[model samples]
Target: MAGGGGRSHGLSSSRSGPTSNLLFSCGKVAIVRTVKSGPNVGLKFHGCPLWPVSV
Candidate 1:
């Protein structure tokens, strides 16, 4: 029996092959953290490389 869930289409196609690169690649990856503002501050977090950056 074959496992079902993800589809083999678009970037998932075997022809495309496996990759470790990002789709909408950005300059560099950065560590996102929370601000110490009010009660929702100083919270460290992770985020995309192109969060608030524009090419």
Candidate 2:
């Protein structure tokens, strides 16, 4: 049940609104790894179970 909130600043400010709220259950380890070495880094998901309908 741990979470956080913050405000964006500078050129990275979003005019559309804030980022999406990520909701996850307990015991889930969320790892957001860097895919690139630039200002905008890509993300890859790991250890998440796939749904039958989505597959």
Candidate 1: give the clashing pairs.
35-41, 35-42
What are the clashing pairs of model 2?
none
Per residue, candidate 1 scores C-alpha lDDT tens digits across 1-55 of: 1355774312211245544332323444434557658885786644455567676
Where is model 1 more than 4 Å wrong at Cα?
1-30, 36-38
How much RMSD separates candidate 1 from the native structure? Answer: 10.0
Candidate 2 displacement at residue 47 in angstroms: 9.5
* lDDT agreement with native, every candidate: 0.45, 0.35
RMSD of each: 10.0, 12.9
Score candidate 2 by lDDT. 0.35
List, residue by residue over 1-55, the lDDT tens digit for candidate 2: 1233553211122255545333234333333344466665685533223212352
**Alpha carbon deviation, residue 32, candidate 2 (Å):** 3.2
Best by lDDT: 1
Judge candidate 1 against the unseen true structure and give its global Cα lDDT, from 0 to 1.
0.45
